[model samples]
Target: MPTALVTGAAGFIGYHVCEQLISNGYDVVGLDAMTDYYEVSLKEARHARLESEKFTFIKGYVEERDLLMGLFETHKFDLVIHLAAQAGVRYSIDNPRSYLESNIGGTFELLEAARAYPPRHMLLASTSSAYGANTVMPYVENVRADHQMSFYAATKKATEAMAHSYAHLYDLPITMFRFFTVYGPWGRPDMALFKFTKAILEGGSIDVYNNGDMSRDFTYIGDLVSALIRLIDVLPERGSAPAGETDSLSPVAPFRVLNIGNSSPTLLMDFISAIELATERKATCNMMPMQAGDVPATWADATLLTQLVGEIPHTKVPEGVAKFVNWYRDYYKC
Candidate 1:
């Protein structure tokens, strides 16, 4: 079996990716810090569900160079998926240091380890927030994202640059995926879907940001994981751009970046309505102004993702929201 090392293995997306890999007969090693950014029990519960002989769990921060180096030395990982990061746009505004430590420093540590024990391919998780203040609809990969609205996005963009340099200098095959608003079962508590579900179930009001005027290309977890698995085999090579294709392939390095999203921006109000309908409860809305480090909208141009993976995420909001609501009720017994 091919050996794969997945960082943030206990995270919402990471857990799902590990499950997918294990089910496909990969020997997976999962690393998670189990940080209290949310409920530790929730993460523990997700990890507990993946208990299997093929899956090995490690508890530690990826920024720890010694620990990462040791793991790389011990296991010859064929693929490395870096998914652990300090996530959340608003949280980065208050605690910029955590983003620096985890997003930047941790990625540096991973690059160094990969340099020593070179993997066949390295996939890093980036956020659509990296598109920052771009007003362009359906953000594409080839466009220059120089203006970041949040410290979190800035750090994620910095990692892209850092990864590019490593790929150029070491000739490492790297693919960085810019993820849109990912939501589904086992989603993060800080995310909109989770918070809204909890509030509606408990007769509490949901904070509708931007007065419910915002929009997002909410990609479901299953679709995102499927895209990721497909991308693992589509490694980039140093070459000129393909004719009439906006491939983000680097000319000097075997590196590429693609957006993995639903490509359909849904209004925030519609999203809330989906949740309300799923739970069969009316939400008391606290219409609030847009928070700091937040954009009013985000949509992805997933052309490159389709070109490479041969498919795009097609989960509609209503169906995805219903699934999340059912899982939340069953998991928490609400």
Candidate 2:
């Protein structure tokens, strides 16, 4: 079986990706720090569901170069999925050091390890927040992204540049995934969906930032995992971008960037309505001004992704929200 090393294996996306990888017959080794960014119990529960003979779990920090180097020397991973990052946009405002340590230092350590034992492909997670300050609609991969609004996003962007340099110098095959707002079952409690659902179900008011004026291209976890799996073999060659297409493939390095999103932005109020419908309750919304390190909206242009991997998922907001609510009710027994 092909061996894959998945960092952040206990995280929301990491857990789903590991489960999918194991189901696909890959011998997966999952490494996670299990940081108390949110609820540790949720992370542990996700990892618990991933127990399998084909899966090996490691609880540790991604920034530990010695630990990562040891794993690289031992397993010779075919794929390295780096998703272990300090991940909250607002949280980064007060905890900038954590972002630097996890998102920046952790990625540097991973790249250093990969230089020694190169994987077939290294998929590192980026965020739509990295598309900072750009008011362009339908974020295209070829569009120049700079002026990040959040420290968390800035760290992720930093990793993108760091990985690119490593790719150029070491010829390391890497694909940076600019993920839109990913949400579904086993989602992070810090996310809006989870917070809002919890508050609404508890008969409490939900904080509606920017007076609920924002929108997001909320991609479901299942869809995002599927997109990732499909792109695992879509290796980037220096000059092998599809003909007559706007590709983010680097001209000098075997590296590329792709946006994995639903491509359909839903209004904040509409998302709230979806949750209300799912929970069969009206939300008492507390309107508030936009917080630091937040954007009013985000939409992704998945044309390049479609050209590479056939059809992308288009799960509507109401449908996806319902699924999450169902899982939340079942998991929380609320």
Candidate 3:
């Protein structure tokens, strides 16, 4: 079995991705710092659930330059999935340096490590927030993302550029996946889905940001993991460039950026309604103005992803929300 190294294997998406990889017969080495970004217990619980013979756990921060380099030297991994970062839009405003350290510096460290021991392919996590200030519906990979509202988005965008440079300079195959609003079982407490579910279940008011005018391309966790697993084998090449005739693929490096999303922009109220249906409790909406560093809507143009994987997140809101509710109720002993 090929060995895969996952940077944030204890995170919401990282846990799911690692689980899928282990199920698919990959030996996964999980690295996580167990940061108290939201709840360390949640991360621990996710890691505990992934206890398998094929899984190896390593406790460390990604920003540890020498440690990460030493790890790459020790394990010649077949693939690397970089997901550790300072996530959340609002949190970025309060702590901008965290984003710089984790997203930018951590990525630089990973690239430096990859330089010594190159993997077949690397998938780095980028967020739909990187599509900052773009009014265009269904954001595409080729879109010029020059304007970023939050420091978080800026750092993620910077990672994509940094990864591309590494890909070009060291001939490292790289894929930058820009994730949409991913939600499901093991979802982060900071995200809207988790917060709304918890608040409504406890008979509290749910904060409706932007006066409930916001939207997101809510991709289910399972479908996103399936897409990612399929993409593991479709590695880009350094010399074999993508045809430039209206193609979004990178020209200089063996690197490509893809939007791993549902290709559907869901209304904020609609998402809340799905949660309400699942929880069997109406959410008391506290209408609030749009917070700083938040966009009104995000849709993904996943044409490239569809062509590559022959699949995309098609699970409708009701179905996905119900699954999450089931997991939440069972896990929390509700």
lDDT of 1 at 218: 95
Pick the winner on TM-score between candidates 1 and 3: 1
TM-scores, all candidates, are: 0.98, 0.99, 0.98
Off by over 4 Å in 3: 241-246
Model 2: per-residue Cα lDDT at residue 67: 91
lDDT of 1 by residue, 1-334 (tens): 8999999999999999999999999999999999999999999999998899999999999998688889999998999999999999999999999999999999999999999999999999999999999998889899989999999999999999999999999989999999999999999999999999998999999888889899999999999999999989888887756423688899899999989999999999999999989999999999899899899999999888887768755999999999999999999998
Residue pairs that clash (backbone atoms under 3 angstroms), model 1: none
Itemize residue pairs with steric clashes in candidate 3.
none
Ten contiguous residues minimizing lDDT sum, candidate 3: 241-250
What TM-score does prediction 1 earn?
A: 0.98
| Candidate 3, 170-208: lDDT as tens digits | 989999999999999999999999999999999999889
lDDT of 1 at 272: 91
48 Cα displacement, candidate 1 (Å) = 0.8
Provide the lDDT at 52 for model 3.
86
Displacement of residue 202 (Cα, Å) in model 3 is: 0.5
Worst 10 residues of 2 by lDDT: 237-246
Question: Who is ahead in lDDT, 1 or 3?
Answer: 1
